[model samples]
Target: MLMEKVAEILREASAEAVEPRFRALASGEVMEKAPGEVVTVADREAEAIISRRLRELLPVPVVGEEAVSADPALARALLSEPAAWLVDPVDGTSNFVAGHPDFAVMASLVRAGRTVAAWIWQPTTGTAYAAELGAGAWRNDSPLSRAGAGGDPEKWRGVLKTRFLDPATQHRLQTGARVFGEVTPGRSAAGMEYPMITDDELDFILYWRTLPWDHSPGGLLVTEAGGVCARLDGTPYQPEPPGGPDGLLVAADPATWERVRGALA
Candidate 1:
């Protein structure tokens, strides 16, 4: 119930939100948060739209990256509420500020410390990915179906994985039989390094990160897509962690997940 309704709201808001900012990026005002962190008027405006819409759709309290206390302790305390919403109005702010389309508007519903549902919308691309606790994941209007095993690795495509790796790790990946592409920084790029496979091309995607807003929606998307999601360390992701760190690893298919995990390990 919450998942379907929330997904619908996100898709509707995304349609209204994506274009204005997509066009404004070049002329958009920019600001700095830290050495590698940046924000823009577009980010703030988008957050406002998402927050307002979410508030209207669900009465629960929301904790967003830009609107909440930055301290991990404070964030943990605030998110520890029995039922709450986690939002990343723009999950890839750096990409957005740089005029890239890889950014996303993400949201998740957390109940009793567990994420029950999630939504990730790529505004620029007009793609919506969503999922719920027991319901399967979906993209646009289609339910995600599982891919059967095949002899050719080229034929073995399914839900993809995305990760942020340093140059060394990138090199390791190149030595393997896996096929991948470097995600271009700007433009509404979904599926980046790991993409959801449908019709022989990457489409739907769920990015994993420690940011509750980012991963919560993505996790739900994977689960609803009939896939599994977890941290690289294979731990259940919690929006409110005892300590704060944002690293995550996710796979769309269970078999693919096992192979990727084994390779990484």
Candidate 2:
């Protein structure tokens, strides 16, 4: 119920700040956050709106991707809180800048280092995915479940971001694709992966970074939809900062997780 409310808020904010600018971004509307990272006016405006609304609804600290980027201390402040909100106003900023359709607005409620609720909204199609830990995941109010077992490693399909790894690690994984089945590079769209996993279009997703605003919400959505979510070290997942010791690896089920981990090992 709380997540649904959050989703509604995101939907409204996204419609206002995100949708209208989809393919209409002006020359100066886009700015560089980093060499490869980008930010658009839409991202900033939507995040500001969501941050204010979320704070009003819960009166808790809010950590948004754009807000934290502007003020690093805000990130630490939110993480130190017993309960706080994590918002990725526009998860796939790159795609959004490129006018791609694979983008989402996501938020998660992290209580004492654990995600208790998650909501993700796909603005283009208006599809929403929501979950409360232990209550199960849902797609637009319908109960959701992941696909059945993948047949073989050689045939398994998943999203893999080897580019995020060190060069040696990337080369090793690339040359040893036999053990990995099929690993496609994703669009870096945070919440988009879980929908693919839930629909059986993807078997797993391995990301080399674990930003809470990017992965936490989707991680719980996968776990509640009958998937296995953990770090590469096999610990239960929590929202990790910009650089953590391990990355996020999620599979459609426990068995698939072990299979993929064993392959990596």
Candidate 3:
């Protein structure tokens, strides 16, 4: 029931605060929150709606991306609180601002430093992706699982997102990634990438940064779908206990994860 409720909240937030502003963002609606990190009016508005609804639904700390940007300390709640909600109102703010269909609204329920449930709502496709820790993953009402056979690392297709890494690390990753048969700097959207992984559109994705809101929901979704979402060192990815190694690798399955990690990490 909670999964269904959160799914509804995600849809509501997207409908009420995201879809209408898809490409209609005004001059002041978009702004750079950090040097290259962008946020939009839709992000703030949708976050507010999602956070409020989340609090009412579970009364936990709602640590949203926008809220954390406003007050970084709010992020600590993910470590200290017994349970909390992680929200990324616009997972692809840049895409949304560019009128691209790759953006999504995402949220995850974290308890004792672990993600237990998650939801991703893509307004453009009118699709809701969800997962409960042990209940498995879904696309709308249908179950979702990794759909392809794993192959040699050299024949794998995936993306390498190294923007957040240091120059040296980036170069190393870029060099190491040559082993893959097909690699591209992916669309900077975890919400979209995770779904693609589950659907077998890609074999793996290597991320240099693992912001909780950005990765938690999709991490759980991928894992629940019989894929693997973990830190580069093979540690389980958790929302709490913030600040760890910089790499995250999500793949179609365990073997794919190991192969990718061997090549990149």
In model 3, residue pairs whose N, Cα or C atoms come closer than 3 Å (at least 3 residues apart or on different chains), thus clashing, are: none
Candidate 1 regions with alpha-carbon error over 4 angstroms: 1-5, 8-18, 26-28, 69-74, 77-79, 148-209, 241-247
Model 2 RMSD vs true structure: 1.4
In terms of lDDT, which candidate is stronger, 1 or 2? 2
**C-alpha displacement of 24 in model 3, angstroms?**
0.8
Best candidate according to lDDT: 3
* True lDDT of residue 110, candidate 1: 82
Which regions of candidate 3 fall more than 4 Å away from where they truly are?
none
TM-score of 3: 0.95
C-alpha lDDT (0 to 100) for residue 28 of candidate 1? 34
Model 2 has an lDDT value of 0.85
Worst 10 residues of 1 by lDDT: 180-189
Q: Per-residue lDDT for 1-265 in model 2, tens only?
A: 5766798899999999999999999989999997889999999999999999999889999989988887777777445888899999998988988889999999989888889999999988779999899999999999998875566777788777876688899877666555666788876796787778877888887777777798888888989999988987789888855655567778999988888877765
